[model samples]
Target: MESHLLEVLVCPLCKSKLDHNREQQQLVCKADQLAFPIRDGIPLMLQSEAISLSSSET
Candidate 1:
């Protein structure tokens, strides 16, 4: 992911900062406990497309 793009991207639900998980190619929102997937270098920021993080993940 591009650093510039990552800096501007935020969680679509909570509008919070996201941490990049390079291995999974996802943007993780710790506050919202959601993971937004990145496909073909584009982030799918839609809430419906996000995966909820488990309690153990937090």
Candidate 2:
């Protein structure tokens, strides 16, 4: 993901800052316990598309 875009993107559910997980290619919202997937370099920011983070992972 581009640094500029990463800087501005937030969680759709909670409006919280996201942490980019480069290995998984996802933007994680720790506050909301969600992970937004990045597909083909584009972020899927929709709440419906977000993956719920496991308790152990959170």
Candidate 3:
């Protein structure tokens, strides 16, 4: 993902900043415990498209 894009992207739920997980290719919202997938360099920010994050994830 581009750094510029990541800087502007936020969680759709909490509107908090997202963390980039390069290996996983997803944007993570720690506050909301959700991971928005980045497919083909595009972020899917919808709640229904997000993956529930386990407490173990950070």
- Each model's lDDT comes to 0.89, 0.90, 0.93
Candidate 1: lDDT of 56? Answer: 84
Off by over 4 Å in 1: none
Runs in model 2 deviating more than 4 A are none
Which is superior by lDDT, 1 or 2? 2
TM of each candidate vs. truth: 0.90, 0.91, 0.95
- Considering lDDT, where higher is better, how would the candidates rank from best to worst? 3, 2, 1
Weakest lDDT window of 10 consecutive positions for candidate 2: 49-58
How good is model 1 by TM-score? 0.90
Judge candidate 2 at residue 12 and give its lDDT: 84
The residue-by-residue lDDT of candidate 2 on 1-58, one tens digit each, is 9899988988888888999999999999999889999999999998889999986775
Which candidate number would show the highest TM-score if scored against the true structure? 3
Model 3: how far residue 20 lies from native, Å: 0.4
lDDT of model 3 at residue 56?
94
Residue 11 error, candidate 1, Å: 0.9
**What tens digits encode model 3's per-residue C-alpha lDDT throughout 1-58?**
9899988988899999999999998999999999999999899999999999999987
Report the lDDT of model 3 for residue 18. 98
Count clashes in each candidate, considering only residues at least 3 apart in sequence or on different chains: 0, 0, 0
